[model samples]
Target: MAADKVPGMARIAVIGAGMGAMATAARLAVAGHRVVVYERAATYGGAVRRFERDGFAFDTGPGLLPLPAVYRDLFVKTGKQPLEECVELVQVDPSSRHLFADGTQMSLPNASRAGVVAALDEALGAGAGERWGDFLVRAREAWDRTRRPLLEEPLWPNWSVLADREPYPSVPHKKLLRTRRATTLAEVAAWELRDPRLTALLENHALAYGLDPRTAPAGAAVLPYMEHAFGTWYVRGGIGELARAMYERCLARRVEFRFDASVARIAEKNGRAAGVELDDGTVEDADFVVAGVAPGVLDGLVPGTALRGADEVPPQRGASSRLTVLLALRGGRPEEAAHRTVVHTPDREDELSRLFGERPGLPAAPTVTVSRPDDPALVPDAEHEAATLTVTVPSGLPVSESAVERVLGVAERALPGLRDRLLWHEVRTPADIAEATGVDGGAVPAPALAAADGRLLHPSNSTRVPGLFAVGGWAHPGGGLPHSGMSGALVAGLIVEGPEFRGSQ
Candidate 1:
């Protein structure tokens, strides 16, 4: 279907107020369209939000930010300097701390291969670091080769079509297809390394996806490359700075914003998208729409409109959901440092299940995060030091006040006197997150990119519905702030210049 033409200043309505929506609004505004952003929440920035209590502050999600260039490009498009003006991000060393089942520990540094290797050598044995290096080289090669071609491309129709257009084979695709998801990271590491401790350390990397190493993709086992190559960082004040920066850019480009507007329906006429219908029965006109919401949320908003064809349906989301506990600590959390401290118990997977029980919720003590020399903008410049502890629990967990106490009880076991030290604690169950952000199942996009018959992870960013696009974490290139931001760019390109237009030029 041809895109509807809007005279003088085109009206493009972007759904959601998260980073992806902001990015699209900024881009479209720069492209000579008058844009309007609709957000249901009181504030913007879906998962990457911040909260404060008793002079202490905490970022809700996406604590570790990388790939600053992605942010820089979006800012530049809006004639802003994100790096210089919006945030101050310091390169953090020791990207993470892994606490093993036996109380063994390992720390990872940003881009510090030698340091990580040395530490692994001390914790595990000689040459284990070197083995990891070999693994990373392969991952790097895959990352570098496919990042631009496959990752950034919108892959709804079929990957083969895109592959045919490319100049060469996709290394990332090749590697990813060969990876075994059911095989544990421990099994793969054992095959590559000698020491048991080294194997455990290698398996721990799968935690980034919130998956057990045993069942996570082998390609995921190479995630450490992102840390070493790009480095882990926190926005000067908090991750919310990134979202605010995007919002500022959108506003500068004249992107109109509507908050407290719950989108109830995506109006379609004759099997084509026309505009959106708000929950309050308000109708807005638009030539094109960018849906930055979770696909499931879209399913509810538009109903059967997402149906691509008689046989086509939106893909199924993974069952593994997430639980988060945000804490404002009066005193420091000594068990961990700046970025992350992942505590693994014996039979970690089973322990995780127990933590959540039959429902979704936080585990005992779980994983903790502490930021040092805390950024005052995130909180009031206060009299004492503060910390935020995030523990990932079961997704869709039935969280109650009593459940909150139980999780806190577990945290105390890991960090002595932690419960008493808390200035306040906020528990975010999946339902709460869903209510706050319009994420279906509280699963913020990031849908598992199922392989084409166990061969490739394919995710669709383009809706079968013409003139409509999908962006954000659950779409193409999968989740993470960088990839989600990029998804917006991909949809904008499709709208501004179709494939035919690109080929002709």
Candidate 2:
């Protein structure tokens, strides 16, 4: 936790207790700055909350961690104790078990490129594995091109160039005597992978994040590459435990937290951010302010200020939300079961069309992600188990009772005799998420991607207003556990090292 103080340590204020905000708070405190965090909620970890009932606990947010290096770097920069010391981290052997439309099952090994290709080939056919392996090669190319700009570093001034350029080097396909390169993720699957099951498998990466493959940029291939390269990990207790560790890291670094403290607005002084004005009209002045909430919430806090330039990438809104069904099962978790299982929808086109088409509504056959962690921490005893089923749905839509039933039916593909083993189940709709994160419609933001005419990029961390900066899911690099953590590092660098900060050396 030892860090030299700058010329003069200044008082800094942070909004929210989300992972990104806490990461920034911990690092700033280590750098010898007086950091105070204000969270409107009674607890930390915004959407990364846990639901517990009758001795069964489940992470209501992200169930698995991808590219954990983001948080590892945060711990390294903040304190002497590594992230592993704070939380038990274990890699899920089989990254994921997928049940396709034809009842074909594929269990891909974690962090093994060769094993993944073999698994895909074994399940889908020899050519299926080779085609997917080829796609991964192209995906890695896209990751290499955009990794620094979209992630580690601050949003560049020439971000428009990133928006206009496609990082994915898709092979040109000859169609109707015309050559055309894949521009969208769906095209990538159709032209290159060339198998219906393979297309669904590749597009599932985007679907899991609520991004429609039909329009998601080809560079979005990096999503699966990230998981394939870094592997999927679990925090012993639950993913929520990572949030607890992060909050504790902040406290240990002398970062003060004000829970249940609401902020009304960002205080301004002579055209610069002065501090924060509380909901009760109390003003706490500081040298700089970092907001970690959604773009709309941040704009609301500064009613008169223009947060971004007219030409800057506009804040992405109303992507999609999830419907989660938490199950308390009467039987013990089978040791051989994979931690995560995805049951692909029977009809991909119909599912996508219904969810993201003209009139957005619940899909008749939604792809369901079933999580059955073999951890004693989630259950009362060895005789009981905890399981969660999740599927992306249109944000702001009313989730009917029948919709929940449909998702359960799809989940039965992953969990055999699901209803028979279920002791009780609780459903969480987007409205519940809206209540937790203050994001309208409970919509989750997708990670930023290159191309698609700047549609996927987020606003710069540094805003037009002096001494004001943005962090977390809604800012540059966009959402997800890893992206949000990286946003915190970028914001801290811009503040502590100035806007010229190029990122970690």
Candidate 3:
């Protein structure tokens, strides 16, 4: 309930209580404004929402946690304790495992570039480590140069911001793309080193992010930096705990919470966004509104003209699809492996080619990600364990019992004894994802950026509609938990400091 005692103050409405909305509310409240957030789900946190079923907890979306500083920034700026106080982070070394058909298994390190190179040398061969160092230095530079212009800020008309000031007319934008995607990571490794296993192992990451390395941008190499530098982490209880933490913070800030309130339309007046109208005939109004929802959803809700050149916002790239099987196990599995594993066959190159790029159907065998809920809070006790195994498949795969059995057959071939280990399980398909999130065609917001048209990837925070702002996966700092949280804060900062903010009444 808003404090009526605090008289004469402007009320700010943040639509969607996901990471973006929660982050926005925390910052806006600290800026001395009255803020109320309306969420369309049973609880706060949109795609970031989590749920517990029969003692098994699952994050609705976003299973991996990386980049901790973004969260630290959100809390410190809001005059709250850091995330460490909320959740304990454990680094999973040999960050990921890869099994090849030749019966060779390679695990990548959760160490620095140098450390990663050393590990590669030890795992693959001698000189391979040094080449990795050289590659990483280039990757780091690319990340430094583009992090702000491309990922953080909206990248539309403001493309000029990426301009260079000297005799060398800035890194030719094409060069960046050519460098990242010119040769697939697979091809690059094959050329740099003699080990086919290493090349195929390195190249497979393309499919992980829903891109084909051959066609995916070189900017992708930056992905290793965060994972190797900061180390992959898990929320205390489950990935969902992060969402709950952000939700708690929102409550403390006195942000209004409305669940099961689906937004049907964005209210606009005189070419300006006034507020949002919920599906059940309830109208919530505010001076300024920040939408933390997905862009495709926005495309449907807002007036097409409200977003300048909305038509130009490239149509959705069919998102990467996944066949997720959640398991409730009697006891923990082998402790020898890290929290995550990547199992492959000897013919990994062809297999990965099919997985990462255009493939006819699901791979005869799919790469599997096995994660046991290491966070105790997610499970009842040490005797009971919950884990999820995910296999990336082409989007729009059929989700029938027979189709599921076919995939499971492949999983059995890889794990050899996977079926006997399962106590109980649940399977989620791309269709399930689409129905749950309401993103157009259920495409997960893995923005595939190409140098030629990377500008279309992130548009500026200003939605062109006066008094309106956009946040979350569709806005700056693309997808991922940390990025979204930081984006929420950034959006709020823009509104509070920008000319649009209407101070307390």
Candidate 4:
């Protein structure tokens, strides 16, 4: 059915004030819909939160933004001002500095494949660059094959096509007088990359997203390709600035926002979503409802409303959650330091085993990402610096004080004298994530991938109910800054252009 034939202007009730929800609300309002966002919290941005103390600020959610073009398109489609006008986007040069177990360190240039290859060769040895560069070529092929189906379009009826097909064109490797193609990411790393350090670099991409490289499909190669191709970015102040900009854009488009309003249930009438029932005993009627929440949360919102698509929802039992430590240093940040630094764990197998093992525990040597932005906005003065350290741990695992210390120990590799310079530190655990994002177990959702036993696939954006839609990281296209932003575009397209809409051209 065409949008014009569906009905008049719709009264859209969004369940959350997250980036995806706000993005959808802005687009739907631009399409002549009456949009209202009801957020259980007193603020917008969901997990995109910030921490401030004694004039030092730190981003507790995503430290950087990737594929900023997602938001660029959103601003272009909704209003006159582009995203650049709303926020200051700075490309992080030397995309990241990596510290390997062998004490080999290298800083890679932003979005430069050749430069990355050269840096690896210079740091790791001769022939290393060629191997990594060759792997990237195969990765690019996988990206070309799966980009549209996985990121651009909605989850199709025959999603098994994606589930069954391995898009990565893995070169045949001969071992023990047998030839076979790599299926898992670890296999690709060992068979193609061939160096422990190179394998670590390749696997780190998957590990960061909560995927176990040993089991993540070879198609997971797209993760590194997407980042290396698009480059990493930072919003001045913090990533939360992007959220504030998105919320502001929604208000400018006449989208109403109600804070501290919890949705009790989704109202259904005649097999369609009619509106929402608030916990405060109020019923707000709407022609359409958009939900930006986790799958478990959605299940409770509409009791007895069976979810459509997918046989079983992926469990969060072994999913990964982040542990962030915010440090307020009493010294100025060095001018020559890279914006981001990754300290690789010495023992990859042991770390992965601990993280994904039956009884998850902190790795003896955990891989840690340290972010130290030079922007003065994050510090009070030249004498103070704000830094954030992050590590991936099994979701719902009890994080002990020692676990927090272990993360700081790994981070100290990037920041020498970290303890001496620190005035005070704040720890944000999975419990904090659960409270902030309302995702039980605080499991951070990973981006959707083509293969891997369908463990990486998310639910369809369109639900079983006629007028209800899912629009967030937990929905189709999955998580990360770019994916969530795209979810908004996809949901808006399906609602405004009709169910027949495939995706944005």
lDDT of 1: 0.63
Q: Per-residue CA lDDT of candidate 2, range 1-505, in tens?
A: 1121123688899999998899888888998999999999999998899999999999999999989999999999888999999999999989899898887898989999889888988898888888888899999999999999999888889899998999999999998989999999999999999998888888999999998899999999999999988889999999999999999899899999999999999999888888999999999998889998988899999998888888788899768999999999998888899999989988888889877888887767789999999899999999998999999998887888898899888888878898999899998999999888989999898899999999889888888888888888889888999999998998888888785689866
Model 3 misplaced regions, further than 4 Å: 1-9, 154-156, 160-187, 304-306, 310-316, 345-360, 406-416, 447-452, 499-505
Off by over 4 Å in 2: 1-7
Q: Which is the better candidate, 2 or 3, if ranked by lDDT?
A: 2
lDDT of 2 at 22: 91
Candidate 4 regions exceeding 4 Å error are: 1-6, 309-317
State TM-scores per candidate. 0.85, 0.98, 0.86, 0.98
**Best model per lDDT:** 2
lDDT of 1 at 18: 83
Selected candidate, larger TM-score, 1 vs 3: 3
Tens digit per residue, CA lDDT, model 4, 111-196: 99889989989999999999988988999999999888888998887887888899999999998999999999999999998999
Model 1 Cα lDDT, one tens digit per residue, 171-266: 232244584322334455656555666655565555445555554444454355666777777787788877887887788888899998888888
Worst 10 residues of 2 by lDDT: 1-10
What is the per-residue lDDT of model 3 for residues 245-341, given as tens digits with 9 covering 90 to 100? 7777767777777777788888887766777888987777777777877776776678566474653344345556667777776765455646676
Note the Cα lDDT for every prediction shown.
0.63, 0.90, 0.64, 0.90
How large an RMSD does model 2 have? 2.4
